[model samples]
Target: KRTSLSMGEIMTIDVFVERYKDMESILNDVLEGTGANKKSSNKEQELNSRISGLQKIVSDLEKEKEMIKRVDEARLT
Candidate 1:
């Protein structure tokens, strides 16, 4: 059995294959986030730590509403 494709079609396919390979490499990097950027991973960790700390502060503030109210009133006076 013989299948035939025109030269233009073959060239188009080659171009698409090369572009698809680049896209696949980018996709792989996205899927494997651990290797793409050490600084980004470290920054993410630092942001997570800051988020945890901010959450603790919010929790503490919520638990100390009475003290906060007192402070607000004292500031007004």
Candidate 2:
């Protein structure tokens, strides 16, 4: 049971990392288009807000992944 749970957690960490990378790519694309025009400033603002939220989620997931790693290591001992 413990081994399966640990494996599941490890899988979750991989998924989270993949999602973070995707979100980061999207954020970078949005940022790159910032100077294209002035009319879509509002849209840019909305995208920025969403990107910030995703950033926070990614950060939290990373911390969770680290915590899980520590727990897994402790279990090995």
Candidate 3:
């Protein structure tokens, strides 16, 4: 029987965190690139709105993934 969370599980969490950070960095760059044009504040507003929606979805998925992982680990115990 498994005594603890497997190496694969640990690695998967690490990978998720790394990818999340990478995505955040990419999103920040996109916002910065557009923000350089101050006259397009309206465009920025629309972009921010869309980005927020995407961010919310990502965060929700992450939360669900974490909850599932926790439940799996509990079952393993």
Span of ten consecutive residues with least summed lDDT in model 1: 1-10
The pairs that clash in candidate 3 are none
TM-score of 3: 0.57
Off by over 4 Å in 1: 1-3, 34-77
Q: Write the per-residue lDDT of candidate 1 for residues 1-77, one digit (tens) a residue.
A: 32434447545555655555565555455545743566457655655555455455545544454454566567669
Clashes of each: 0, 0, 0
How does each model score on lDDT? 0.53, 0.76, 0.70
lDDT of 2 by residue, 12-54 (tens): 7779878877987887697668837664587777877787888
Tens-digit lDDT track for model 3 on 1-77? Answer: 65445657757766776666667677667778989978458877776776676667667756756776787778879
Highest TM-score scorer: 2
Query: Which runs in model 3 stand beyond 4 Å of their true positions?
Result: 1-27
Question: What are the models' TM-scores?
Answer: 0.38, 0.74, 0.57
Error in Å for residue 25 of model 2:
1.1
Q: Tell me the RMSD of model 2 versus the true structure.
A: 3.0
